[model samples]
Target: NTLDYDYTNEEYDLIYNPLKMQGKKEVEVEVWDYNKVGKNDIIGVVNIDILPSKNKETQIELFIQPKNDKGEVQSNLNTDQKLGKISFSMIYIPEDDYLKRLRDAELKKRKTEQELIRQKELEEQRRLDEIKRIADEQRRLEEEKRRQQEALNAQYIKGYVQFKNISVSNLKKMDFIGKSDPFVLFKAGESSQQTTVAKNVLDYQYLNEEYEVLYDPSVMQGKHEIEVEVYDQDSVTKNDIIGAVSVDILPSLNQERQFDLFLQPQKDKKDDSSKSETSSTNSDKKLGKVSFSMNYISEQDWIKNFKQEQLRKQKIKDEIIKQKELEEQKIKDEIQRRLDEQKRIEEEKRKQKEALDAQYIKGVVQFKNISVSNLKKMDLIGKNDPFVLFKAGELTKQTTTAKNTLNYDYLNESYELLYDPAVMQGKHEIEVEVYDQDSLTKNDLIGAVNVDV
Candidate 1:
């Protein structure tokens, strides 16, 4: 095929596919030189071989030879010759092979899509199964946990109720001369906890006691109630119901709360026989109010608290003993001080009596007749002369003898002594001495005499 060049000098593209492919392997081209003359001269003739698998565009070169009318090769060409060579391309493509390849590619795409769809379905199924398994395991674990908690709670007393100040309000007077003999009866369900009587107190505090009960949160948390009733005792008639109160056992675990509940009066004994669970009693005849506090305590915890209380009480007892010892010591010290004070007072009185006795003087002394029994001798045959002298205290008055010679008649003499009353009253002493006149040596002496004045 020959194509015309465009009007402008620009590049051109061409795509060609064969409609019929028999067995053509090569192509031939002939060129003729044309002029205004008759019979165009043969310019050249060219031949090209097709290359296998060259489906894309290709370029080729061919050498052409000039020929005359006799069909002889011309070696020389004038400057006015039209053409000298030819260039073109021949591409051969196998249509059957290309069509087979297209069909194979389409088949491979379909297979890949089917495999992806199958894998998606398998993933969805696995997700659903895992969700169901997780749900079942969670439910089983929750059931097990609930059962364990209940068992632990049942092993101990988890609740307590303390009843105190159970009294009556508008008490029905049972006696004429005195007030009614009132009493309180406390009950946990049907079991009686305590029954105590009082003589004549309107707001009587009958019982202050703590009671233990089982408290199961699953079974009987808020439903458990403690019942309290007041009754007026009598000698001849049956006990009359004063009032009754019921308090709910609160819900808690390891925790406690206190409540002050009022006792509602029940119907007359002729109407009702037992205490009702409801507080729908005679409002006008409200027996009175009951004061009590309830608490929740596990059995083990309750025992531990009891031990702690005992220790506290023992410590207080020891402190009291020490205080008593101190008081006794104080009393003994006070007695000793009083005895010492009394002894000191007695000693002072004795000293005063001694001082008064020293001021009074009353004793007297008188010298009687005195004689010299043994005198100092001056010679063996001659007798010596002797005389007696007397003295008392500081003042001494000797006796005035009225005899010429010293004789036994002259020995009797009296002396008068003077002294301070305080000094003389204690000890009034008088002294008497005898002396003899010697002729040659010192005076011979007779025996001396001493006396108290």
Candidate 2:
């Protein structure tokens, strides 16, 4: 029907929750006021149009019109009728975006969760010092010291793995080349990456590549194996795997250990009968050998100390960042304090300047000429008697009563109103009110003029 409720001081808050406008892009929202004393009256109504864009955000404005019954428009701003205005701007988002917004929020939450998961994983990794056994530490250190002296010439080494050479097996001479383009591939760990391949070993330049591995000593003590494979690269066909080799990672942390890794055929290939020269060697060719050496240097103390230094630097940086944040917070607090002080001063000035009245005024207030017109007929004889009392704008009331100008009008009277300028200043209105002298009845205020002094 019609909305009609008087706005009271008890209920000042007006909040409109999400007005789900469905999937419609264009909708009209109307606001009406129907609070009259005895009946309902249409104060105003406005139609809101929703304008939405995907790439850019926008805003819209609608004007409200005050209307009375019979759909006629009216304006009441200048009159006593105070049907206050309402600023209505509705950004109608379609309900179809509910899932989109939910998905976006979910995506953000998942990303945050993923980052936290990675951080937890890094923290969970086993540390060397944490796993180092206290009982065996002394013996391990003593034994590592002896190896350190032996490796001192290389000087403060971490660890190094050397790949020497590879012997092939069941190798087929690829195509018309009559020579196999052969190379060896080797790596450590589970991931296929980190494989150190041999260079310059087309003939017999063994021990071509070296890989320096950083391992946690106190955490890792078991033998880690190095996997090696030999490949025959053909120009036209897919590369043929000659064989594969598995070599154990060296155990010593200081002195290097040398060993020979035997290679075996990865897959059985058809025997070539025409190559009678290689047929005799085919049996020996199928089985091959790979020579390699792995070395380790016990420098856990140096690595540990360097890591500690880096951690100290990071701690210092974190402290600096924290201090910067605190300083920024302090600056923000200071700015807010200044703003609050400014607001307080402005409020004080507003209270003091509420009225255009004077704080102190000094001047002679003398009623030079006095006249009373349009006097109400009194005394029952159609005759009137009127006199005037002059007062200034003050609490004590700078007042002066003039003698009755008997009959209907007053003679030109000059009365000096003693005004204390030490108490008041600024504009003071001289109020001249006319009163009829009635000994039996109280004095009647017929009219008054707020005169400027």
lDDT of each: 0.58, 0.53
What's model 1's overall lDDT? 0.58
**What's model 2's overall lDDT?**
0.53
In terms of lDDT, the poorest run of 10 residues in model 1 is 1-10
Per-model TM-score versus the true fold: 0.37, 0.23
Q: Tens digit of lDDT per residue, candidate 1, span 1-453?
A: 232222354444322344443554445457765668689766676544556526665775556756667765454323334455555655544666556755876787777777777877777778778888888888888878767656654543444444443445556565676777777676654445655677865666545544555444444442345556677788788987766765554443355654444556564658523433433442444445555545656656767877998998998898899888888988888888888887788788678757865654654445556554444554455565666776655655544432224355554455445545555545445667666655577755456656644
Q: Pick the candidate with the highest lDDT.
A: 1
Q: Could you tell me how far off, in angstroms, the CA of residue 273 lies in candidate 2 after the best superposition?
A: 34
**Which candidate has the top score in TM-score?**
1
Clashes of 2: 13
